[model samples]
Target: MQSGLTRDRLIAILMLLPSIILVAIFVYGFIAWTGYTSLTDSNALQQLSGLPAQFIGLKNYNDLFTGGLNLRFRIDMVNTVFFTVMFILVCLAVGMGLAILLDQKIKGEAIFRTIFLFPMALSFVVTGVVWKWLFNPTSGFNVLPTILGLPAGQFRWFISEERWWPFAWQDVPLILSILFLGIAIFAALWYWSKRRSQTAALLAALALLLLAWITFGNPRSLSGLNPERPEAHGFNVALIAIVIAAGWQMSGYTMAMYLAGLRGISEELREAARVDGCNELGVYRHVVFPLLAPITLSAMIILGHISLKIFDLVYTMGGGDNLYIDMPGINMFFTTFRSNQFGQGAAIAMLMLIMVAIVIVPYLASQLRSETKL
Candidate 1:
């Protein structure tokens, strides 16, 4: 029986080998290759001549953050933060509002739900293109004012270079310290509740170290990473239009998730809340919202991931030449293709990967810990 079981396991392994090998070669292999490229001083000529790429260590990264030529990248980072915040906030608000309305079982509910969700069927590229024309200052939405006998509005939309909520690069360390310490604390709380003492202890230690560093250590040394030390980073006003388009495209997705979560909730629980003399708002505030926390978290994680790697919409909506509304994606494209700076391009790609990983890995770790019941 032991020999037979061994043979069965061997056969299963053999059967799965091809898929495992493919994923390793295509996915993991490419990531490794990209990392290597980022460390090299590769350029168009070097790549074409089949020359051995010169390893320049972190020079490419240094150039992006301190060499002063890639200020657009710094702006892209600012735009991303503001865009992500507004996009997620708007989508959550609108989605939850819609879900609550549909939960009322109003007339033509199916039709309304379908109408709201129809945008999800379209790609971001499509949404961007449509919104681009709609936001034309002289024609699309601008003409609406004329219909009311007002002069055509002069909002430049994505063409505008205006900014808001400005901050210096010198303040980055403070933000990073707070953000990382918050994550560490959150992880510790979760693992501790699971009774995973070792993991929880490690997380607590990490949190303590971060807190100590922030409270006592010289965090100022880590600041001033931006190349243009005095240049301001801010919420680029041009990104607001992009946020609206993104929110419209994704709000329905969140609405569906919330609707499913709401429906999954037992009506008896809601009735209990009412029986306890809880008003409609109180029922949602105390019972419904708490129960829907997981769904909200899941939606935020997914949406945040998308927002970080946003490329196609911004590319298609504003075209690649709009300097006022440039994003990391567009910057990477121009660097790699137009300027043929493979090293810098790869560095940008790696940074993008890091940003997404930061958002995803924590959530995945927590999910696995819960699943294992440890």
Candidate 2:
């Protein structure tokens, strides 16, 4: 009987070997190849800046952590972390909040839900294209100030360098004047936020803020002030755009997941929480959230992985020029193709794979452990 069972297990493994091989080839194998490439200065893959490639083990990685010409690799590593954290938090907050709100027996909830979720069906490439048009400095909400009889060329939005961050509470006056001067900014925000969709709210808020900053905040606009530092360029704006667009798209799906998880929860638990002196917020915070931890963890892993591997949206949205791809991940693959440094490109791909793994594996293990205990 033992021998027969062993034979059966081997047969099952053999049956599954094809799929396993497929995954290895497409996913794990590709990553391994890329890792090998990163260790080499393989100029045969692609060439840029006339830098000939040779076997430079860990040199590229060192430069990546240190600095390169554009300082892009290092910047991008930081951006990746920042982007991942922000994306996960924003998507969870917006999605989970909307899920709760829409689940509250509201009328026309399905229609509203569908409207919010429709963006998920789109490819990242499509999302980027649409956002590019919407974010176009001259033609988009950036120009709304001028169109509404505000000063001509008053708003710089994404283009101006003089106005960036508000350092403190006192500097907030600058942020607010820039906010109020842009015509219809508040109106647009109100319209978007009145609905339950977080994407609409976020977009509207950004539009207003960017409008205000460009119109009132920029020193260049206030006077003929030349930039002391060079204007911020590269794919930073494009990355920002991609994050916003992708976050908007993903939020709806997250909302759906949370909604399902909420429904799965027993009504008695909520009532019990109330009897225990918990209000609605308290019940959600203390009871619902704890019960929903598994689902939330699952959702977080998905979003985290998605954020790490988010290439198509970043690639297609904007900043495709050689000057722009200089920003790291967006260009890393292109660099391999252009310079024929397939190995280096592969290495970048592998690095991204590692990042995704780092985020997901431990979370999944914990989730499984929790489920087993339950």
Candidate number of the best TM-score: 1
Residue-by-residue lDDT tens digits, candidate 1, 285-310? 99999999999999999999999988
- Please give me the total number of clashing residue pairs in predicted model 1: 0
Compose the digit string of candidate 2's lDDT tens values, residues 207-286: 76776566566534332222343323222333454567778889998899989988888889999999999999999999
Error of 1 at 162 (Å): 1.1
Work out the TM-score per prediction.
0.88, 0.70
The weakest ten consecutive residues by lDDT in model 1 span 220-229
Measured with C-alpha atoms, the lDDT of residue 45 in candidate 1 is 93
Error in Å for residue 39 of model 1: 0.5
Q: C-alpha displacement of 4 in model 1, angstroms?
A: 9.5
Model 2 TM:
0.70
| CA lDDT of every candidate | 0.88, 0.67
Question: Candidate 2 local accuracy as lDDT?
Answer: 0.67
